[model samples]
Target: MATISTLSDLYISELKDLWSANDQMARALKKITPQATNAKLSQLLEEAQTGIADHTQLLKALIANQGEEVSKEHCKGMEGLVSEALKHVLEQPPQNGPVLDALIIAQYQRMTHYGITGFGTVAAFANALQMEDDGRQLKDAVDDLYDADELMSELAEAAVNREAAEE
Candidate 1:
């Protein structure tokens, strides 16, 4: 944890944090994706893992592009979120069915919302520092994360929730 005196320092630091976050979420997803009985939810989790990896690579590349050390500080923020997600869906998970799927959606959204905030904030930081290319790339990552979040919401509203309610 280095002192962040400049906007560039903050931006690069946030990027590293996001990289750690993506890695944590990726590992958590691997543990829980198979717990999803709903095919759609499982599929979404699979796709999200790939996207997270891609975003992690982007974070690394962005840090290197800034001539930074290309290393990540452990993201305690995401550490907590992943902890809660696993506790909710794995440590004491719901039954392996629609109910579980709904719970998974809820937990997944919580993590994604964290990601959305982090990435969006970093994008803004990049723009504030006049790094338009980094800003655009990060904004694109935000969009990808948001799209995944939205699809989970749609899946929940259209199917998972209803099925869980009937359960």
Candidate 2:
């Protein structure tokens, strides 16, 4: 018979995955920020820096609260996805209308999607483990990230798509 996974173990594993993904994302965003040209994109990058810093601190606190040290295990899945996105971003730098915007939107979404999954998984684990306070905190962070993702998607549809199609 297959063994059922304990919620505590599941939570710990998911947190480690998220921690790893967040570290990688911080590195990726730092690289991509310099490439952003538009005012909106620049603002997004700056805001992302602040948000990520906050999230990193929170993750550390959570680890400590749980009587564990913050350690990042390798998140191979996220690494591959981030790597592919980075390649695309570098290969197709956004120049003027549409094309650049499309590329920016695509790249931003890739990172955001990874974060959403990681945050959601971690939140689920927290809930299962009956860590209500931790779950709420994680949920708040995830929601903010999700909002950013949604905004990026909207920008792509409203501005990038129309402009790119015309060019």
- Cα TM-score of candidate 1: 0.98
Candidate 2 residue 165 Cα shift, in angstroms, is 2.0
lDDT of 2 by residue, 33-66 (tens): 7676556766776787678778877877887788
| Tens-digit lDDT track of model 1 for 2-59 | 8999988899889999999999999999999989998988999999999999999999
User: Residue 8 in candidate 1 has what lDDT?
Assistant: 84
lDDT, each prediction: 0.93, 0.76
Candidate closest to the true structure, highest TM-score: 1
**Shift of residue 130 alpha carbon in model 1, Å:** 0.9
- Candidate 2 residue pairs in backbone clash: 94-100
Question: Each model's number of backbone clashes?
Answer: 0, 1
